[model samples]
Target: MECRFPSVPGAERILSDEALAFVAALHSRFGERRRALLAERDRRQARFDAGERPDFPTDHPGLSDPEWRIASVPDDLKDRRVEITGPAERKMMINAFNSGARVFMADIEDALSPTAENIIRAQINLYDAARRTISYRDPATGKDYALGDKIAVLKVRPRGWHLDEAHLVIDGERVAGAFVDFGLHAFHNAQALIDAGSGPYFYLPKLQHHEEARLWADVFAFTEEWLGLAPGTIKATVLIETLPGAFHAEAILYELRQNIVGLNCGRWDYIFSYIKTHRKDPGAVLPDRAAVTMTVPFMRAYALHVIKVCHRRGAHAIGGMAAQIPVKGDPAANEEAFAKVRADKEREAGDGHDGTWVAHPALVPVAKEVFDRLMPAPNQVDRQREDVVVTQADLLTPCDGPKTMAGVRMNVNVGIGYLAAWLSGRGAVPLHNLMEDAATAEISRTQLWQWRATGTRLDSGETVDAALIDAAFHAEVEALREALGEEAFAVGHYGAAADLMRELVQADELADFLTSVAYERHFAD
Candidate 1:
């Protein structure tokens, strides 16, 4: 018997092809199994999409009473240094802690290998050591006494994404308050932490988008309900270390406002993110390995972005960690490096950042010293009216038409130079063949006010009010126009000038720009 098939040219051609023939043969051999496999994949994907937490086991116990609570540190200890280690690593922790740091985070996440048994043993040792009064003989006096709270913070590794071996074991046990890292995804081990009665608080890492922040909020909300914790108790500190996060910092903070305690600049991950994000661009030729120094532009941008975002949201803007420090053997190099760190801290404090972080215990005293030196006394700059100031000079200078781009270039150069000088605490520095401290106290007020309007945090650790911010905007616009009088007219650059005016009108943009400039100035050296 002969069978007749459809006469469609395209379909017939496909069937005649060798590749199709082989595919058909394979399907005939295992089509049922393939269909079942596809269905299973879809089922798993659907579960994932439906917000089902994956069944990953954790050794950490569920919270007996889950509640949202803010962790507090002593005021004097706020500026102190911290060390990271456990009892097994006690010597290292003691060495670092005694050097100068105010706190110690017994690190089991990045520093230790992912061995379930080992991790459990370390946690037990850490818990036991922290609960008891530790004594160390003072090398100088050869005397033994209880080490004054040898550790301030205890950090635990709660089985990260790739760490599926169940390294974290809780066994229904509770230790005095300790901080845990929820590594990468919030929904992954969140329920476990809550179930074990571990607080809803966590250190969130590698946050890339505002949606991710929102996702964290949602997960916290779910975990709170599931574990019966208070609504706002699930505090989080986002690790802003990606290019997307850098750009959308304001959005992220705005979305996760109440739940976040602060934002931190993760230098190493940020460098890696910068490389990964921009590697495709031929013009951006970056070095093979990111140097530990802060000279890179993107690095500065990331740092400043964190400050701007945190300050805007009334949260702490903790600076990046000064990871490298000179050891005791090299006093001169140590002092120089320490001095540089202090200078950087001073600049951050001056820019109105809340605080900064350092990895080494020895660097803490220097960090605190710099922070203390730079921050202005509370309420030094007062609220003022925008219309009170009058100036004939135009704050905005327009770039000339395409035909005379050179004139536009000159205008840009002059404007930037003036702005730079004004920012450098040298607004009165001589330039253009003239010497004058042209920047007045009013100008200083205007600059600071402009920065404050951006929702930048004040030294008092509060977000600036919108009304005062608006007043500052107008004042800066007037002052900038006065500063650029004839130069604004020379290039016929009214449009550019107007845009600048508009930017100064908005506090957020102004704050971001000012902070970026500050970072560049401090670390660009």
Candidate 2:
């Protein structure tokens, strides 16, 4: 198999001939299947646009079987009380590894800016992280950083199936992004992790069907065999981040049952999925992003449903992300932020979730404190949520509240601000005291587009239309420019972001992924 990619700094060490072989092999076996599944996603979207609401999935064979369970996870994975997540950048990885959380999810998907450089950096950084040799020294401060004696368990999240890796072209085409992320790490570091008593653990993202789970299962099976590892050596937790995914929660677990360890409530993307899935429907227009809390009826149902399905299948039910960051110098605001985090973690722990995710390391102890008090056990997998009975209506219910000018402005500013940073090679940016990633960025842009498409009337009685979108868009651009200052704003990717934002909000149809558009327009180098 032939491979072509830019020779970045760590290219030689990370993408050795053997590793390239593994990548090519996986792509050869599963590349066509990946495209087919993505197409299926489009077909499903068309069905929804044609007025068919998402229904509860009950077609899989294992949904009715009560005795079956997911395969047992390795020892280190058992007690994921709190997990800290960030991009696989050096210092961030070290901090997350030493955050005292039970697990650290080094995210190469939503949490990473997948420029060719960042992609190569992540692979090298993760390889070093797996071997416990990653370190960094700040050029400005000269402060050296390394892993702690007692580090968190390592997990990696690859990009979704819908993405393609432009940097690495195989057979005259871009390989599936997920394959490169999962393959390079697994090829170079899987054995090392296993030799150190931990397997190649992963968090699968953006799955919308059980068959996608099945494809991943096959990939896992093949990797284990090719690497001469035992069956079930590769354990994964699927993120129920899509509306269709929440509907088929049980079936998805069953598809990957032999090698799967759990399911996660990816709340941010799930919200985006809800809007995207129902983009053409006026009735599903959501209100302010702040108004859509986890306790809302539909989100609550989805979270509880994930817990129920995972626990019943004897798998861990990981909770959603606490994206709040501690604001410096504003004690009152910080207290309010911590209070929100406390309440959110309490809800998850009290609801029988085994663990949860926190964005910043400061919030790690905050979340761990909640879970430590609520869940004494390492995991709550044994606690079957029997009373969790979710229906189509409960799962499909959108939040009812005000869609205000405030909401529109927020959507526009965040859309441009986050995208500007993202195009400059930063995936996770703290805006307004909260960590913003691709998932949250998706929410920002999609909400604007959805509101615009639906002509959603705000509580202020202004109907969302072309004029309103333009007003909000231009205002947010200028506001971001002023707020960020002249020099900073000039170098920012605001122009490109605004261009994409305009395309998205004014399009006759909603775009699927905001990152995809930005990836093409800005990452053409």
Task: Pick the TM-score winner.
Answer: 2
Best by lDDT: 2
Give one clash count per candidate, in the order shown: 26, 0
| Model 1 regions lying over 4 Å from their true place | 1-106, 125-201, 222-228, 288-295, 376-525
Cα lDDT for residue 218, candidate 2: 97
Candidate 2's TM-score reads 0.98
Root-mean-square deviation of Cα positions for candidate 1 versus the true structure, in angstroms: 23.3
What is the alpha-carbon lDDT for the whole of candidate 1?
A: 0.41
lDDT of 2 by residue, 1-525 (tens): 444456878779987888988998999999999999999999999999999988876666878777898888889999999999999999999999999999999999998998888888899999898889999999999999999899999999999999988777776878888999999999999999987778899999999999999999999999999999899899899999999999888899999998888999999999999999988899888889989999889999999999999988889999999999999999999999999999999999999999999999999989999999999989888898898898899999787877789988888888888888898899999999999899888998888888888878899888999998998888888887787887888788787778787888798878899888778877744
